[model samples]
Target: MCERTVRFSEINEIKEFVSAACRCKFDIDVVSGRIVIDAKSILGMLSLNWNEELRVVYDEQDPHFENVLQKYMTS
Candidate 1:
């Protein structure tokens, strides 16, 4: 499994990202004030509080999968 922090300035980009991420399941940690939820559903993504960064967890070594998520990666 690999993990990274990412930031999304636009919500529209999520659909493309989520679709490309189909190969591996992603556990997204959304932190909003006093709440934290492990999100995997697209609908749950909409509930995330937009910020400068969010953590994503994925378990797979597919080069293509990494490539697909590369743009969203931070450092």
Candidate 2:
């Protein structure tokens, strides 16, 4: 699996991020502490801890996935 730290500072970012995730072919999960939610679900994502860093985890390992991931990746 591939994982990256991410953050969404504004409401629009969450929408865009979830939209991007929905386009992905593989399963994507957002993990924060003990909670993990379906990345493609806007409602599931919104319930996460947006105030802190979270992980974007995916089962696929490819350059295309990496490119798509750039839209949500945080420092």
TM-score of each: 0.67, 0.83
Give the Cα error of residue 42 in candidate 1, in Å.
1.4
Off by over 4 Å in 2: 61-65
What would the per-residue lDDT of candidate 1 be over residues 1-75, giving only the tens digit for each residue? 667776677777666556566555544444445666454356766677655577766555656656756877778
Model 2, 9-42: lDDT tens digits are 8878888777777777889999999999998899
Query: Ten-residue segment with the worst summed lDDT in candidate 2?
Result: 60-69
Off by over 4 Å in 1: 25-40
- How displaced is residue 18 in candidate 1, in Å? 0.9
> RMSD to native for every prediction?
3.0, 1.9
